[model samples]
Target: MGRKLLSLLLFASLATATPAAAAPTAAPQPPTELVTGLSLPWATSFLPDGQSALMTERNSFRVSRVTLDGTRTTVGTVPNSVTTNGEGGLMGIAVSPTWNGTSDQAVYLFHTSTDGGQTQNRVVRMDFDGTTLSNRTVIVSGIRSNTFHNGGQLKFGPDGFLYAGTGDAQDTSTSQNDSSLNGKILRFTTSGQPAPGNPFGTLVYSKGHRNPQGLAWDSAGRMWSAELGDTQFDELNLIVSGHNYGWPICQGSCSTPGMDNPKRTWTTAEASPSSLAIVDDTAYVAALRGQRLWRVELNGENAGATQAYFTNTFGRLRSIVQVPGASAIWISTSNTNGDKLLRSVIQ
Candidate 1:
């Protein structure tokens, strides 16, 4: 990598006025490993104080705590979770925006569970007492699940509502069905009811997702999602209420009526995106199969040219969370023996 910066200009349309220009920022420092020996850690939710973080491990159902100095401990476990090989078990986790570790100390989780022995994915909330978990509550249930395509990504949007991305349980038809909870982004109140002002009067916020895994709201409050396509193109979509994302009908972009196109896309081999984090107006996506981190600069809702780092240096990047109060991000790798937590500086 060169230290010299190159100026890049982008325009939305040919008829647009003088284009806005963005110069290449300085290359970031190589990531520093924070912890090791994690078993398929899926998502990372940082504590507001920034000294520690929570990590969820798939197939293990254990929530581990990672401190700034690389200490690790099993803080809690999601009970009744059913493990799956390809894509199941405990998945996304989030810290409640209002949690203060005292009166409202709560953490949220998304996992595949067989509470009824019928097999399904569900969302639950657990009380985090800063060292261990207690007081489990099933907030949402009955979302479809399968060995694959069980999209599990959770985050609280700027509106303070919990938003989750769910898969169609390998049933492509469900992506287009409004009545189905699968293949949709769901919005709910803090207690897990359908949020007010929902476009469909239900939990479904948007539809037509083929294993969408990543969600982040930009600085302007616009929501964005990173979607997985079947053996073709993966997409970064601008999510809006009640919009259809064209899953089975269209892979990338299409002119089909009543279907929305992606703002950007990448080949499946290059970017099987899993989790997204935004910092300094740039969206950083963690890729599982692609084994890299992708940075896409955001100009309002539009995405600029894409850049990738640590292409094969790290094996199967899974989750990334921006460290609060700093220009650094905590990252997790997916390789079995090689799984480790890393901190990469943002530049």
Candidate 2:
């Protein structure tokens, strides 16, 4: 072959060999089942040594220690102030950020409760002795609630601030009202006080959301939220301080006049995103109604190259947590009526 022809052929081959920046085509190895027999598992927290996890059951209001071998023992039941209903009950839980045999170490929980005939969401801190719970205290409360759209996701940000995502309590207008804690991501100290120098001088960190179910922070300390939209847009947002994410006004994109658009949006069928975990530069979204795991590459909050996996492997994916020092993702299956947990090892 002529030298010029050979060079052209080599370039063409290289182009064909490179993968496109869309859905990953390489069939990831089938995920191995980790544990089964869980009743609508909601959230998971890794132990300090990463061998065990604490998982919450939604309707049962039960929190249990799940070992790597799939053995489960009930730690304790979350204090219930109201009856468990659709999408209400024990929701999110996180271990104390400063938990190193400290006296103040506790497991924090976020759930919906009924008070005076009005449903409300609250955060409570419960002391854990590795076997049971003692000394439960309400950390923060007064979040509007309803049968659905009770945004219940909590995590400690790298800045040591306790962040909670709240829903609009089925009232679309509340998302835009600054005075209402509903439909916003709240930032507060461990003592449940609003962080000093908040943008609004209150617990409201950012406003204008529908039902935000996922909260995650990247290594750069940037927060991202996954929200369920009303029959239109399911959004993934790069949460910024004091920025408004238009809910009823704007569904998707940046078309709405004073609101920030999502980094990416999907149809409700494609992603009813429940929870998210950012590993390296990739954001993995756990889908509930969509029943899939979405992988979105992150370029400084702006998303690129999206992919989906686990189409029908698990009925409903509730949460995804990265296993530290391992190339695996621990996924909670909401086969509540069925009960199962899965661990996905990315190949």
Candidate 3:
């Protein structure tokens, strides 16, 4: 069977027992803009104080800390090692999870740079001295790189290890190669060693992804990933340990043997998911080409209801980060083509 037909059949089998319900629609509420005038913001992470956030701009290789009062300051440059091309550059940033009551902690970054023959992806750590970055070190490197499909998103999982989302670098076969780090979610120690008790007992936690830009865990510690599809079928998946997500072989919902299926899939026109944040049972996905935010309700392992918000008000929503203890969310604008950073207060 064709890929799409097989996917539909699999989804039908999964949801066959339940009656079809109407797709959830977001309640109409005006979005209050918190800040503006940012250039191609890629990611956002809250400072330990909870009132400020650090954001990364893709093309500029600049990182800035913005306060709730609307002030912005440059934390530091991400080093001139990055080569800014189509979809590659300074992409993901995360503050050290051990940043409580200490000045020695740092923020981590994932970016693409040129080696000798081809571009490469590397992860670097930078010390934050309350005002600027101090010592910087490249902790991980040698991942596949290209002008496009350079998946660059990083997060610290509850397991106290750093998790990084990597793209296929436009090479489809790389997704299934165990030796290649491209097109996979890599789990490693804070010092960049492969984390203990990994599925492969190595850095690779899961494989067979196209371009996974979203990585977030629920309150139950279940890891979830949002992937950008090639031509159709953007997906939200419950990331299983050591399972293949079937990128080239299967796109969205999978019926093929030995492959995990997505919990939910949407037409690429409706959802070009980039970044995701989970609060309680709701998974908020940031859409880029779709130009909206998808709020998907999850009950255990099943998708419950889905809704879309901010339909063209903010242009391309590149990334969303929920405030640790607040009701507000920080959304980065993909003005890489033309947008701005926006802070959304859920009303």
Write down the TM-score of every candidate.
0.92, 0.89, 0.89
- Prediction 2 global C-alpha lDDT: 0.83
Candidate 2 residue-wise lDDT, 1-347, digit = tens:
99999999999988887765455533234677777767888888876667777888888888888887778888888875453467777888888766643565578888876545666799888888777866778888889878888888988888888889998888998999999999999999888999986789999999999988899988788999999888988999999989999987888886777799999999999889999988876788989889888998888868998998988777788988877677678888786687677777765
How many steric overlaps are in each model, in order?
A: 0, 1, 2
What lDDT would each prediction earn against the true structure?
0.88, 0.83, 0.84
TM-score, model 1 to reference:
0.92
Off by over 4 Å in 1: 1-26
Minimum summed lDDT over a 10-residue window in model 1 is located at 3-12
Q: In angstroms, what RMSD does candidate 3 have relative to the true structure?
A: 10.7
Candidate that beats the other on lDDT, 1 or 3, i.e. the better one: 1
Best by lDDT: 1
For residue 243, model 3's alpha carbon misses the true position, in angstroms, by 1.2
- TM-score: the better of candidates 1 and 3: 1
- Alpha-carbon runs more than 4 Å astray in model 3: 1-29, 100-103, 115-118
Candidate 1 lDDT, 1-347, residue by residue in tens: 33332222222343254354455584445899898878788998877788888889998899998887879999989888997677988999999887778988889999999886777899999999889988878899989899999999999999999999999899999999999999999999878899999989999999999999999988899999999899899999999999999989999998999998999899999999998988887899999889999989889979996899999988899898888888888888998665899999976
TM-score of 2: 0.89
Please name the candidate that would achieve the greatest TM-score relative to the true structure. Answer: 1
